[model samples]
Target: MTLDLVNYEQKAHEAVKSFWSNREVAKQKQLLTGKADHGERAGVTAGKNMDGFLALVLDIIQANGLAHAEIHQNRSMLTLPGYFRPTKLWDLLVIYKGELIAAIELKSQVGSFGNNFNNRTEEAIGTAYDLWTAYREEAFGKQPRPFVGWLMMVEDAPKSRCAVRDASPHFPVFGEFEGASYLMRYDLLCQKLVKEQLYTTAALITSTRCAAETGEFSEMSSMTGFRPFVTALAGHVAAAAARLD
Candidate 1:
């Protein structure tokens, strides 16, 4: 059966819009009313606002016909054993009768692009290695290799769109990266993640605070577009369903 992609992009955009809107409202309501101290990080709990995006992904998975699979998103159940580490909590996980099916990680950044881009990249690469290595060690038991995916959302702003200067100090960076912006870097990152087989598919999406409410967003490349990401995921889910009761 063909996957229903009608308005999928807009739906994903709405999820992100809800996330940002909640964060802003929570911060303003607390700070402006003087109910919370400015030094206390009033909106600190807003980090989990991204759960909306997670839910949207789960919906897509279920719609693709794996609704009976043992899917997990709760913090406790999300933790899976790794070869390099004892355990790692993923954003989403799926299993069928104890057989590993798929795992996905979702991440987003609104500011401090320079300080966080490298960190995010490192974590993503490391997580994939750790999971696959663990699978190699039979951490999740004997089953076909599980599908892994990565999705990232970045705020569309001037700072993130401006090209960054690279300092190789020893060897010049790759030609394609010489004058790439953070968006381009992320696009390359997602594309390479799939190219290198680190993740089954990776998607990169961007939206601005002002345009987010209207469910407006843009894709950097077809490689990282939502359609490709969801299409790959649906295929994986369908395969896993054959093993389900």
Candidate 2:
């Protein structure tokens, strides 16, 4: 069946918009009262806040006739055994008839680029490595390899857009990363994740707090764009549906 991507895009926009709105509300609430709420005390953890977007993905999965598949999103059920680590909780999972179908991780960054860029990159690479190694060791039990995906959303701010200096104490950094912005860094990260075969696909999206309400978001390229992400996911669900019987 043909996919209604336009509608899906609108839903995604709304979902992201709501995410930012909730963050702002939480921030403001913290200001009024000295007590720190969830987002205020710690930081923005959009992972749990992204259920709306994940729901859209679930819509695609269900539409493709994989509604019978086991979908795990709860914190407890999302945990999957890892090769290196004891267990890792994924953002979403699709299991069917004892076979691993798909696993996805969703992340977002609003600010603190300088402090968090390295951490985010390390987590992305490490997580993919752990998951793949576990699969290689048959952690999921003689099942078909699962489709892994990563989707990252970053706030469109001056700091993130400004070119960052790469000071390599020893060897010179690569030409592509000599003088790149945080946004560029994220784009490169996603591109490399797919290029290195760590993830089946990855997407990078950016949007401002004000623009989010208007459903405004930008993508670096078609490869890291949301359309490609949803399309690839939909195609995978369709293929998996065929095997359900």
Candidate 3:
């Protein structure tokens, strides 16, 4: 059967527009209420900045297959057992017939790229490792392996595009990262995540602040692009649905 991608490209454009618009709205709201956070934190502390992307993912799940799957987006229903911790909360979770089908993590970075990039990298690797180890121990019971996905959106700005120097006093860093930009680093991270089997698929996208008006975004590479990400997800969902038939 042909894979149903559900016209994700247009939906992705809309999601990008919503992402920027929501951030601005949140920032303004916080400022008006005298609760503005430091730097770009005010824009993200509202926590609903990614709702559009979440909705897009939900549409893909239902359109491709698994319309009846229980997709958890609420904070309370998103936690799963972890190997190194009591529980870890995911951005989204899919369960059908009492079996886990998929878990996805969605993240974005608008500013503070230097420190936040490192934090995001560590969190992504650690989360995947913890979940996979728990899966190895049958934490989700006797069932097929679930799809794990990670998607990130970064602001396309001069800072993110500029080459950054690595401080390696003792050992030289990898050749690929010697003078890579933050955006390039993220692309490398996503590629390695999939190559290392940390996540079933990892995607990276970039958009400027003006994307709020134009809904424009760019992909760094086809391997880590949004198209491949949704295609893999849709195929997995369709296959899972077939098993139920």
lDDT of each: 0.83, 0.84, 0.94
TM-score of each: 0.91, 0.93, 0.99
lDDT of 3 at 239: 93
* By TM-score: ranked, best first: 3, 2, 1
On residues 147-212, what C-alpha lDDT tens digit does candidate 3 reach at each position? 999999999999999999989899999999989999999999999999999999999999999999
Candidate 3 structure lDDT: 0.94
Distance (Å) between predicted and true CA of 210, model 2?
0.5
Ranking by lDDT: 3, 2, 1
- Candidate 2, residues 1-245: lDDT per residue as tens digits? 67544368888888787777767666666667765555333335323556667888888888876889999988888988999989998999999988889999988887788888899899999999999999999999987668899989888899999999977899999898877999999999999999999999999989887864686889988889998898888888887778766
Candidate 2, superposed: residue stretches over 4 Å from native? 1-6, 37-47
Over the stretch 1-245, how does candidate 1's per-residue lDDT look in tens digits? Answer: 67744356667877877767776777887777778635324543555656767777787778877788789977889999988889999989998788878899988877778888999999999999999999888898878889999989888899899989999999999999998999999999999999999999999989887864686788998889988988888888876675564
Name the candidate that leads on TM-score.
3
Q: What 10-residue stretch in candidate 3 is worst by lDDT?
A: 1-10
TM value for model 2: 0.93
